[model samples]
Target chain A: MNSNWHEEAYYTIRTYEIDSKKQATLPALVKLMHESAMQHVIKLGVSVWDLEPHHISWVLMRQQLSVHRLPRLGEQIKIETYPSGYERLFTYRDYKVYDAAGELIAHSSSTWVLMDTVQRSLARFPGFILEMLQLAPAPELCLPRPAGQLPKMEKTDHSLDFVVRWHDLDYNDHLNNMYYLQWMLEALPDELLNHGRLRAFDIQYRAEAQWKDQVRAEVQHLPNGRMLHRLVRPDDGKELALALSEWE
Target chain B: MNSNWHEEAYYTIRTYEIDSKKQATLPALVKLMHESAMQHVIKLGVSVWDLEPHHISWVLMRQQLSVHRLPRLGEQIKIETYPSGYERLFTYRDYKVYDAAGELIAHSSSTWVLMDTVQRSLARFPGFILEMLQLAPAPELCLPRPAGQLPKMEKTDHSLDFVVRWHDLDYNDHLNNMYYLQWMLEALPDELLNHGRLRAFDIQYRAEAQWKDQVRAEVQHLPNGRMLHRLVRPDDGKELALALSEWE
Candidate 1:
């Protein structure tokens, strides 16, 4: 992607941001992407908080990350994000991660929706926001695969239960969507975690988890070096998210 | 503390770094303190990674934070760190947090030790490091209070169990010490968390939580607006850390 075509930011992988092998962890990258996207929106002259009086906030519906190589600890990487227009319900954004040499180390595409905080339902994109992000979608970028097409829960090979903690919450007082992704990855076998490097992953957030909600993350092995995962609120039997990951 | 007397850095709290009230959380401040200290150590001409050759690493023993108020979202704050001096086995460092107006918002004192990573035991400070940091201990500073003096667990008022997940592990393959503080705070009463503001907290690291350790966090209420906490590895009955917190 052309560097001038989108908003760009640079981040140095901090010591704590990396894993055992000194490679930046998935959570760190996800945080950067969100931060960058949020900043772009602010620069576009609208802050998410500006929608607060209207009881509206942007929520991630789906995100797909493709990692060619994870940056090392202290490695400075550049990120570029574009609010690549909107469809009927979801607004699309794309991100590109470049190394010092300007090589594309990773890229991601995400779909987001404006949520009605009070009603806990989807809100139509505001006309102002639509105009602010009306840039044409990147022809080179592909949409995150529809969440429905991702595998459903099958026989669970591994599972872990977690209670949403205060730190896991955001200003919305709901469990931040990022923790679901962390729990999904954490439910994987320790052997794979210690040995494998994640190459790509897709996450689709389906439901919101509240503070103190007891949630379970379950993973199933799929054919051909892939894994399918889901996070569910067993109390209500609501599936919170679905994800697919591949590693090598 | 005079600005010239210590190494300083400024950080603007990011969106996700704040709480529901838009105040920067404890974890955010702790991270900035450690980052500034690490950079100071590097500037003194030796990187922590350089110590790897000798199988040595620096470890936090205790930290005490006094917060007059927490900085809010989008606020730029200044942090100053001073590696005061070393005692028989512990090295002392102090941090001061200031608002944009230079008013003190928070301050912290920490005790640390060099550890033989393989042995996981305290190691004597290296001669070169001693020379680099021999700058006189700040006269105005006081040592972090002895951890043993913190209240012992009498009755557990609230408790929560957590499994050390993959993301919790640092590069050393041990649960990064910050998570203990987070868990300790998380186990508090939800009402207190929602309505109260934390005034101060002191944490002492006793042991490391490894990947997949099933750990339990217990908190006990004390008189005069205080609380005590302990994080334990239930399987082996090991106390990983102890903390005391006060709120208003």
Candidate 2:
């Protein structure tokens, strides 16, 4: 892979980004990854601003995030990102977060699909996008392409209903992906949140949830300390997203 | 007053901080002020971490924010803050936000109180805190002292119930002040939110809301495009906060 396709940025973990443990929260970590990708694409001349005139926008399809150790508040961390490669309908990107000591703290791999905002449908990746991205296949995979399908739980342990708020809607006028992880994590028992730390998260977005949409999140704890979370539109029973998390 | 008493920080408006109009949202602007205050206190050797060991913390009592114009997304802004003065039991601080061209976009004046976390009661300012802060009273104020009493609305135009989410709780274990503004603005009618921009916000915090608490926010639109917002605990009808906002 060519190194020119990569970009790096530095950030200081702010108090708002930390959880009760003073460590970065899962959603905050995911935000860092997204920010890194945004910065990287902007540098590549294919940012949202560059695509808006074309009525094109990028959307996340799936992501697998693994944490070695979460960075703490006030810590300076470096986020590095690169385009891994592109398949027929999906483009892959990878991100690595390193703490002040230059130790890898966390990494994530995500798949994205191009969308036609005006048409409200999936669109083929324009050749210009691929040309601008200049993606080169990585020599090795960090994590197996997020499981194609996360198993559905036959039993439910807990559930919560949420009305998508204006803040939850992003510039794209859809619920941001990070909020899915947030709602799922919030549905867990307090015992897990208070005592355990998130180690891994694998999530897939199935459908878009617009502002004011009612979402129902259900969670089922697995025997192996993992949790399966499914979010659906209560009115239509249409699945919005599926996530599996490992906590330690 | 010594100029050293003042501190300034620069921030680039992030995508998540903007509203549909592409301008910084009211809550995001409030957050910038909060972040500026936090940074200033930390520079003075009295950050939250410094007081945590003593089981004491800082809390916002009242804030009066005035906006000339909201900054747009991606705009670089400078936030300047300093201790304005201190009265009997209230410490006053002020903030001014300027756009990249040095145009003042917004300014705020706030009064704060020290709290004893363990006892959950208002506490007197420790002498050491005052000594460390080295506050020099500003020669002028940006806005008048927040009205001592905001008139109770006789009629309500809209109301919404919100169960405080985990994300709403700050490091202090109480609802963050910005979220109060968010909930209030979210409760406004779509026509108002889509057409008007916030001009001023005068808010007073009376009580704290804990996790899972049901908060009902009531908004009454005044004749002058102003709004009176009251947040209360539905079960006991205890008012947590009251806010008055002017829109243009």
Candidate 3:
């Protein structure tokens, strides 16, 4: 039985929680929500051993979250999550984030897909996981998908290169998103982010690159100053990932 | 040719940069230093692709950094790094971190190994890398060995479990050290981190883990209140990493 049940699990907020708006950053909030999901899965006893070698590890395919209210720094909040079943290619998980007084602050849902680690091939959820985690079949919850397919590159006229560093590799021995974002943002013309602030960003992971691999991320500057960034595989023209960022 | 041989690079400090001492944390500093190294390599055209895939990859086997001072919130720092040369089992890289006034605040050197990513084996640096990047042989430069090993864990009877998340994974889909440190620190029984402050912490990476991997970290408390923490694979009980944290 899951020991860390809802009646026993709770998380407290720290003074360092707020963003420049004096509210929590979406990225950080997403992190906490993800943590809550992990806690829930652990409570259910689903672990690493259940993983298959062909396991295409789950990646955050897409997420849609809406905040009815924002929690201030130092405000203790509670989170509850539940499995909402799977679709053709994605497993859905839903969350409700609440403040101490039991007021709902935000509600979110995300889609994830398991992929073969080495081959980078997509994989279906294993039946054992579905039973071990007690993730019973349920009707899929509805949420809006990210608009359009990822913007394509018209051309690769120029590129910026980046080296893989030891610290750059995480426990999975791949690059971290924040640092990857940092590199992509840094590669952009500084004036763009030099005095500006990042409003929102959405990135999709396409493939994994190893430590010390030489990578060239190409950027396409649109007329409006927004950018479509592609992290490319120089050995093959495989587009490893795409990122879209908006700044003001 | 490195076209922007002298073009200045920039980075901003966010609130997350501060550690328990309210100073820029060492791991974060190492991350920034690594970022500087990547930026430098990208500008030099030896970015990721120039690397040999199977036989050679860079692993930060060890690092030794000395900081004369630390940066506070809202601070912007500039950094520069270059390849110093190679030693027997490691490649040496050096860095200079400066404040806004161009005052040098930190000087660091790190030792990295060329590894085979797929087989998890070490490889020798290929000759083409040195030639293509116009790097000269300077085997004299080497990273100073770390002062001590992670204190051995004597508290084998105790264990703490944590759920892993997406934010915990970096671009390569591995958990970042900062998050591991965050987990280790956060797991400190609460009474300690809340009452006292963390003075210093040094840890070493022994192995890498994937996303959703359940981790069990054990801490050995000394009579004087110092702690030795060890993270282990939940199943086979292999030591993943270890750490020592001093509190006041």
- Identify the runs in model 3 with alpha carbons over 4 angstroms from their true place: A1-248, B1-9, B16-28, B48-55, B64-70, B101-108, B131-148, B156-159, B189-201, B221-227, B245-248
Candidate 2 docking class? medium
Tens-digit per-residue lDDT, A126-206, candidate 3: 775566334432344434444456677786544667655444454344664445555555456645533445544556667
Using all chains and alpha carbons, the TM-scores for the candidates as numbered come to 0.93, 0.95, 0.45
Scored by TM against the true chain B, the candidates give: 0.93, 0.93, 0.71
What DockQ, on C-alphas, does every prediction get?
A: 0.73, 0.56, 0.02
Question: What are the per-residue Cα lDDT tens digits for candidate 1 across B177-196?
Answer: 77898888888888887777
Model 1 / residue B193 / CA error / Å:
1.2
Global local distance difference test of model 3: 0.59
RMSD of 1: 2.9
- Top TM-score prediction, candidate number: 2
Comparison by TM-score, 1 against 3, better one: 1
